[model samples]
Target: MLIIATYDVCTTTAAGRKRLRRVAKVCESIGQRVQHSVFECTVTDMQFEELERKLLAEIDQTKDNLRFYRITEPVDLRVKQYGCFRAIDFNAPLIV
Candidate 1:
């Protein structure tokens, strides 16, 4: 499967960049980075899980906080529409 992982640093500090570089190295070994914080990975289900585990561990080793979004598809219709609008679509419309 093809996976897209996007991560954002909470702050633009030296520690943050260091952490990002570590994570980027791990991703680079497994796949290619197509954007500043986004990686395009071709992995099997098991590989994907392992990658997630490694990323979490790497994040824990850093002082900076981080957020990530992982999706199996490149084109997520819902995200394409609502992500730009800062709108979310939950089963309950009120959640948005």
Candidate 2:
């Protein structure tokens, strides 16, 4: 499945800043970042669950927001992009 992950982490406190970095690090390991706080990930059901769990842990329920948009169709068939950030094709090879 194609999953779009976006997060808003509080930066007003030291702990909040730490959580922000942790969330970004976890997402970066399993997905491609398209925006500063949004990511495009291609993951299996189990992978998705684990990713969700990891992300949920880094956020304070009352002070942060995290969204996961599950795209049911093929990614390229549904996504739109503009400017310098290239659109992501999950089925294609991603050279790091």
Measured against the true structure, the TM-scores of the candidates, in listed sequence, are 0.59, 0.89
Compared with the true structure, the alpha-carbon lDDT of candidate 1 equals 0.64
What tens-digit string does per-residue lDDT give for candidate 2 at 14-58? 999999999999999999999999998999999999999999988
lDDT of 1 by residue, 19-83 (tens): 77888888887776666777767677899888888888777434544444555443354235323
lDDT by candidate, in order shown: 0.64, 0.92
- After superposition, the stretches of candidate 1 with alpha carbons farther than 4 Å from their true spots are 60-96
CA shift at 93, candidate 2, in angstroms? 5.7
Counted clashes in each candidate structure = 0, 0
lDDT of 2 at 35: 90
Give the true-structure RMSD of model 1.
Answer: 10.4
Clashes of 1: 0
